[model samples]
Target chain A: MRSLDVTKTAFSNTLRSKMRTFLTVIAIVIGGFTLTVTSGLSAGINQTVDDMLAGYGEEDQLFVMQASAMGMGEDLGPGPQPYDPEAGQQSSTFGQEMLSETDIEFIEGIDGVTNVEPIFFVSPDYLETSGGEQYTLNSLDIPADGPAMELVVGELPERDAMEITIPDTWLTMLDADAEDYEDIDPQIALGETVEIGISNLAFEQETVQAEIVGVSTANLAGIGGAPMPSYALNDELYEIQNSGLDVEQPDAFIQAVVDVDDLEANEQAIKDALQEEGLVGMTLEDLLGIIQGIIDAVAWVLYGFALIALLAASFGIVNTLLMSVQERTREIGLMKALGMSSGKVFGLFSMEAVIIGLLGSVIGLAAGLAVGFTANTLLTGGDGPLGGVGGLTLFALDPVALGLIAAVILVIAFAAGTLPAARAAKKDPIEALRYE
Target chain B: MIIRKTESIIELFMKEGVMSTPVLETENLVKVYGRGPAAFHALKGLTFEIHRGESVAIVGKSGSGKSTLMHLLALLDEPTSGVVALDGKPVTKLKPKAVSGLRNATFGFVFQQFFLNPNQTVLENVTLPLKIAGISKSERNEHGMKALEQLEMADKAKNKATDLSGGQKQRVCIARALINNPEVIFADEPTGNLDSATSETVEDILFGLHRDHGITLVVVTHDEDLAAKCQRRLIMQDGHIVEEQTGASTTTPTAARVPAAPGERPQEQPSRRRRLMKFGKGGAR
Candidate 1:
């Protein structure tokens, strides 16, 4: 028959058994809906993480740390930690760790090292703000005159101003009230006052107030601290305790930032540079093991549930189609008797499955989106414990993740509809004729 | 609408390229059910030819392979190495789609069980074959209504199949079979489910179609009295054609050509249902 008429006919009787159609569609919808929501959430999380990572490190950044300390009591980047037995086993991870400051110098001297900034840091004592804001202070020395200019906020801190820059997030913390602040703007404002203090060594626990000369928006949190531009981030400690012969040079900024030509291309040379400086420098990609481990755990849980729902939905489809085949037995035989080829019989039944699948998937997607969005809102909107922001918890979505989720849902719908259609197609006309 | 007659009854031989060849033909057809372990034989090499301008009856018991023969002859399944032809095409070796296509193009079928699609209207059921054959909407409507008219159920076109009476449903089944103007038609115990009175009336209508339209007809039946009304009879026993007989005459008297059962209704059975077929006079005969 004509494609239109056949489709109309197929659609017309698909719901002949109301309960069967309803149940089958429900199963399929549930399977599809869960898949969409799970995938969407995953996508959103990944997007936020991408933003978080891009602020500090570059993509494909490789970190090379000495695999084993060999009980030498030497520290890698984090601490005097032992190497993982799985270290160096994965092909995509780890470059070389035995690097030097001369290596950094050499990378800087290379043609592609367009703007290299060498950073050496010291971690200072935790300090309370003038506004009573508490923060762990880390001091970093970046090349002020050169390529690090792109990450500059308002202006580079003058060596004499004793100035230090802070991130825009610090403002959102509302140190005055210490609570009740929301990120209501697309871009945070610049220029504000922040406080720092060193204990008894500096002004009897007095807060060292600094004008926020600049704001640095590049993702500094990824590098493990609030990054400042100059070596004087803890200038008061030296002015108060060092030259007076009362203390040593003391901001205690324990880390550094070094720029190379390109992270992915010269990762080996950069690792060489950090090793020469007696510091273990690692790239964002190199430290992704914990991230990968987390990802695997989440994926397993998501896929496990998805598979269960998928199988149940598909089985429901088979049952629906089988019932349909039985119900249309006489009709099927008549079609054959009227010269309908077995192929047409197969096609009609298969088309029925496709119809069911399509309808189920569409419904499922709509349902999933509705439920997922609602859950997301409830989780993020309430005064509940889970409704947190920027403190080791993020819930958001991205376009790539949404697309992937949608594709998966559609594929699931199609798969759920196939088997029963095949069964319908393979039904015997003679037996079907005999079917009551 | 009178066709050329070589002997007042033209025989359409099953051969290639002849459009007017008998719409259905079967030879040495056998169907054995069960496998090597049980192997219950169903059809036993039954052979037959039904030509245009004839209505033939195949009489047998339930297990006599009558339905099996119907399945094979209708191209529902492949025979056990038997050749069946439709419109001179050797369809035994054709693929399933080709068989369906031939069936759609050259034949209509009616069954004792009505076989109406429960969710569809009388019009939709009757329009199905024409739709499958890619007939346009207007044409499908015309043929469908015409077929319903032939069975005296034209007024019930929009009603669901389940809503029709047992006799009315059979009439709609006949209407569905006649919608395509196929050269040949097959009926499987077309009156099996109806009351005796309804059965007699239906058989009369079916036989009337054969006389008036010159379309070939092959009917499977359990009633000897119904079988006797056809122009030819083939008695099957356990899948074998045991006997054959021809009626005294195949022609209808000029005065008796009141109306064909496929194209139009007899004045007595149906009280004034106008022929709704706009395609051709033959369909509204």
Candidate 2:
């Protein structure tokens, strides 16, 4: 018989026992749906991580710090450690080991290290607007090559200009009177001047006036939406804070940013080199690897359940085809007597299985896409749980992965069909014709 | 026009004194059901020759081996030890594929159960043989319609087989058997499940095809009235033919047996020694 005719007949035969076929298809549907949803979930989360990574600086940059600064080797065993005099005399701030000028020069000399700059820690007490209304402030001195911020209406501050960039959330506090934060335009705060107050070592307050060069949107990497100051303004503030006492302040910092070539290939080597110098270098991947690992583990666990479901569904396919073959014994015998070959009979049964697989997977994929896209829309809309996280999609479908999943299910169905098909093919025409 | 053309050719051969060869010949045909002492001998050394355009019936009671003999003759089963020849060629050496191909091209069958797929339409059921032969859909449909028209079943083409009456269903089977234009038609108790009136109608249709189209007809039945309608009869008992008779309707009754051909052995009783040798070969595997 023609292959097309066999396929057509097989499809029609599947419709003979509608309830049986439906139940088998439902089993496959459960497996397919679970597989599609989990794959989409993995895609969505990985895309979100990529978006967050873009907000950080270049991938080849690392934040280096003193290894002992975070109390890594500190003794906490209910006894005071015998500290050396040299260790006690080392400059420290806020219980952290400060990096001296010698440390910066040493890092610059490290092989493969292209550039190294000390990160100055700045703490401003408050920001007083022209209306004399003072609000508490948190500030960061972003370097020229530091992380790029997503802006609302203006650009980053000029490196040499005495200017600062505030977060978009501060627009209402800076310009509004009726406490309507959503109605305030962030562009209105551009070019505005504010006085930043800091405390000197002698407890004297020193204020510096700086222009607002930009407004930045809130983001996951920014933590609490800290304002950023230009390099010139941060230097001036730091110099004023240290001019209080007769003793000359030491040039020390808690951390430094390092730039390197071929960071992906040399990251571990550079980190080992820094470890010998009593320092630690952390890449962005190093900081976020734990999160990525957790997401991957969860996706795999879900996929495991989906695989188990598919295995059970394949058994359903075997059972259904076997029963159909048993019921059609006389029909098969008649066809054989009419000169239909055994191979054609086998092809007919296998085609039935493939049709069932196609039905289940197409329906399951459509349903999964419907549910996934709907959930993504609801979760990412305004006032939703993920609304605060910009550019976040909770479910993302990859067409290639979906196609592979469907093809795999069809193969499993065909494999499950072979046993029954062979049984039908081997049936003796005389015996089958005589079967009651 | 095709029927007249076939008739003219047959007449021409007869006028020229050309002897027509037998369509089917079987010699020393033996069929056993099982192995060892429990073996049931179904057909024991039955020898017969059926010529073209002949209507023959093998009539016997149930378990008399008439069905088994018909199955072997139809190439549906292998003989325990014997030879079944079709068109003067020994078929035992043919591969399974060639055997099936020969059956598909040369023989059509109508069963007592009227083995039509009840869910399919009459047209689909009738065109099954052509479909199995891999004929294109449009061509098969055209041939199917012509066959159904010959059986006076053209109007019922669109109806389901289950919706047809017993006689209508039998006519549909006859239409299916005629669809491939086979040389031989094997009918197993064609009237066994029909009423008397329907049986007569089916009988008329079978006989009409034999007379008009010059197709060989082989019928297996226990009904004496049905057997007498055929031109020849072989009455079987205990797995072998015990009597041969010619019907009253035939003008000439040909000899039931032909002499053994050159290099062929005469028919003999099925011997235990030959069966034992066959069994030993099977046991060694």
Candidate 3:
């Protein structure tokens, strides 16, 4: 028979036993739903990582840190160590790991290194705005030339200026105790001037004024700080902390940024150059890999469970088609007696399986994506459960991946139908017709 | 219009002097089941030829192998060893696909059980073979409607097969068999499941098809009364034809020359109520 007629017959026949067909389809729906959710989760996290990494710096820019002498045996990078109670109330950098001026100059001299920006650790007592509001202050140095952080309002600081960018979260930190607090609007703080007090180790305090150039959102490259300062402000703060004090020279620097000529080709050579200087050169790829690896591992485990569900669903299809064949034995004999080829008989049953699979997958995908998007909206929408971290979707469905998943399920259904279809095809017309 | 055109064409063929060949012929047919210790010989070298426009019956008791011979002649089962031909062409060596093609194009069958799919409409059941033959939907309906009209079941074409009476179901089965316009019609106990009145109605239809359309009719039955209607009878014993008897019937050459239309009602049966229905009009086409 023609394929079109075969398909029509198969479609009509699938509706013969509605309950059995529905139960088989439900099995496939469960499998499809699980796969779509897991895939969407992985896609969402990967998208966030991509956006965050690109916003922070160039792909080749490396974050260099002093190699920890204590965690030297662990080659996975300068990992965190347990904090000792006796080592309480330490500054941002230890004496041994603090970067000196000479060490920064040495890092600048390395081959294949475009330039280096030293990260200065500054301790400030308080930040006082013009409105008489004051709070504890934290800040980090901005690179002279690299990708700049995205601003929620205003513009980035000009080069060689006493300009800074404060986090939108800084106001929240100041109002932590205020009941019924609202988020700090970025528009109110744009181009605002704030006086920051810097205190040296000798308990001498000096205040300096810096204008806020922009309101920036939280980023992964912030070094765990709230505001960002330009090179000039960092220099002035460093001087104020060290002035009129018999300060000891630091042995190591906390961190630095190393720009490369061709990051992909020269990253390893530059890393070796930095390692010789007792430093750890961390690429954005390395940090992103850590997040990506964990996400992928979890997604795969979920996918494994989904695959198990799909396997069970395939067997359900097999059983359903097999039973249908058994029920239609005499009908099959009649068809053959009417001159339908074995191939046509096989096509009829396989088409039934395909239609069932297609129906299940389309419904499952639609349901999954609907539920996924709803969950994402609940978690990522303004002031929702994940209100603090704005613009982070928890589930993202990729069209290509979803399409591939559907196609694979269709093939699996077709294969599962083969055994029953073959049995039907090979049936003896004489014997089948004789069957009651 | 189609019937008139086809009749004119058949008239043209008769004028061309192409005649006297058997519609189907079987020689030394053998059918064996199982092998060795369990071997059962169903047909032992049976040979027969059915001429065009002849109504013949193969009558036997249970286990007489009459059904096996019918299956072999209809190409529904392969003969273990023998030669069967359609229109004098050797067909025993034909491949399975070729056999299926021949069956669709040249033969039709009505079984004792009717074998109508209960879920389908009478129209769907009748046109199924045409669909298998890859006929277009419009043409399948066109031909299927004509076949149903001939069987006088066109009014019930849209009704479900399960809703039909025993006689009505058999008529629908006959409609399906005639939908392909096969050269021969094979009826195996066509009235086995019907009452005496329904059996007589079915008998009239079968004889009408043979007399009207010039379709060679082959009936396999145990009923001597059913066998008596045919022009010739072959009695089977064990696995071979034991006797061949020619019944009392006028051998009119004019009846073969001018084909009879099948919608004519028999004198003994009352006229059926017209259901005011038309095939392919409201049914699934």
Candidate 4:
């Protein structure tokens, strides 16, 4: 028979047994819905990583940190780690091991290294605004060639200038019950000077005043976190806080930044150079890879569950088509008697199966997309549950993903319909016509 | 159009007695069900021939193998042994595709049950065979409507088959049979489900196609009156032809075969015909 007639007949037959067809379709819907939601979640997490990682680090720069000899090859059967009272103190004074002038000069002398920047991390006692409001501050020196942090208001601090950039979360920290603010001018105006203090080991506080240069939308100071300081301000505070400690030259440095000639080609060479000094190399992509690997592993587990649902739905298709074949024995006989080839008979039944699959996938995909969109919106909207974290969505679906889902469903339905269709095709016309 | 031209040339050839081939013929046909101790023979070494434009009826009680013979001749079943030919071509061992091609092109069938698909409209039922023959949609509709019109079922083309009465359903079946314009039409107890009045109507339509369109008719039935109406009748008993008769008015011949008359060639005669009708003048030749 003609393909058009075969398809039309199969479609009409599908409608003839409405409840059975609907029930079969429901199985597929459940499977496809689960699959779609999980895929969307995977896409959403990947998109979030893309957004965050875009602003993470510079292409040609790597962070070099002192490798701890004590932690290497130490697999002390793990419970709560051995409480070392000096561990916290060591981390607190980590920046006091700042690279000396000679070390910096030595790093700058490396073959492929263009520049070397030493990071100075400092903890300030309190930030005092002109209005006399005092708040605790947590600060670090921003890297010179790192990804430019996205800003909500004002501009990045000028190089070698004592200016600080604060995150949006600092506003909430300042006032416990702050209203949702669109711009940050209410809490702290840009270009306004704020006094910061750091107490030296002598128990006397050293206070330094710096201008607020920019406000960032970074999640640096998330809920209950501390604010970030500009590179120059951090360096200035480091100088003022350690002056009375009698710490002239640091023994070891926490971290240093290296600029290389060819990032991809010279990365290993630079890493080797850093390793010679007992330091480790960490690039932006390596950090991103660690985060992505964790996310993808979780997503695959969720996808496996969706596949189980789809497998169950395929059985539903097989059962429905088998029943249809049994009921249409005489009709099939009549078609064969009318000179329909076995191949055409098979095509007719297969078309019916595919139509059922198409219906299920379409409905399932639409419903899945709707649910994904709503969940994404609720989680990522301004003032939504996940609103505090910048550039994060909970669910996402892409065109290619949708197409693959449909194709997978079609294949499953086709395979499930095969046995029943073969039965119908191989049926003897005489025996079928003789069937009561 | 090629089939029509071929039929016309065959008609002219028949007038000159050159290409007078039977539409279908079976030789030493055999069918057995199961094996060994359970074997039951359906057709035991029977041979028969059905000629073009000839209306022949095979009358018998149940299990006399009339239906078996019909199936073998229709190419719907494979004989355990023997050759079945259509238009002088051996078709018993032909490939499936070629057999289906011949079934679609050279024959149509009307069963006792009417056999119309209840899910389809009357028009769709009529066009089914044409669709299987790979005719285009537009031409299928045109030929289907023409065939339905011939059976006077054109007005009810859009109605579903279940909504039709028994006689109307049989007429629709006849229309479906005629849609492909086959050389032979098989009616297996076509009037068995109809009342006497409806049966007459169906009989008239079946005979009308045989008479007017020159389509060969093979009616398998147990109705003696219906069998007598055909120009020739074959009586079957114990899976073998017991008797043959020509016309209802003719006297019954004995079991002995008739001797060939002088100046008559046995090879030229397909099946028994009372008188040859003239061709190209709306008369059977």
Give the best candidate by lDDT: 2
Backbone clash pairs for candidate 4 read none
Which is the better candidate, 2 or 3, if ranked by DockQ? 3
Which portions of model 3 miss their true places by more than 4 Å?
A: A53-60, A66-107, A122-148, A157-159, A172-184, A195-199, A202-208, A219-225, A236-247, A262-286, B1-19, B248-285
- Cα error, residue A195 of model 1, in Å, equals 6.0
True contacts kept of each: 0.77, 0.51, 0.74, 0.58
Deviation in Å, model 2, residue A180 alpha carbon: 7.2
Q: In candidate 2 chain A, where is summed lDDT lowest over 10 consecutive residues?
A: A140-149
The runs of at least 3 residues in candidate 2 whose Cα sits more than 4 Å from the true structure, single-residue gaps closed, are A48-103, A120-148, A161-172, A175-184, A192-255, A261-294, B1-19, B248-285
Of 2 and 4, the candidate ranking higher by TM-score = 4
Question: Candidate order by lDDT, highest to lowest?
Answer: 2, 3, 4, 1
* DockQ values per model: 0.46, 0.53, 0.59, 0.50
* lDDT string, candidate 2, A205-245, tens digits: 98999998787765534532667888788888878777788
In terms of lDDT, which candidate is stronger, 1 or 2?
2
Question: What C-alpha lDDT do the candidate models reach, one value each?
Answer: 0.59, 0.80, 0.76, 0.74
Residue A122 accuracy (lDDT) in model 3:
71
For TM-score, the strongest prediction is 4
- Whose lDDT is higher: candidate 1's or candidate 4's? 4
Model 2: DockQ vs. true structure? 0.53
List runs of model 4 lying over 4 Å from the truth.
Answer: A53-57, A66-110, A138-148, A172-178, A182-188, A219-226, A240-244, A247-254, A272-279, A393-397, B1-19, B248-285
Clashes of each: 25, 0, 4, 0
Which 10-residue span in candidate 1 chain A carries the lowest summed lDDT?
A143-152
Chain B TM-score for all candidates, comma-separated: 0.76, 0.82, 0.80, 0.82
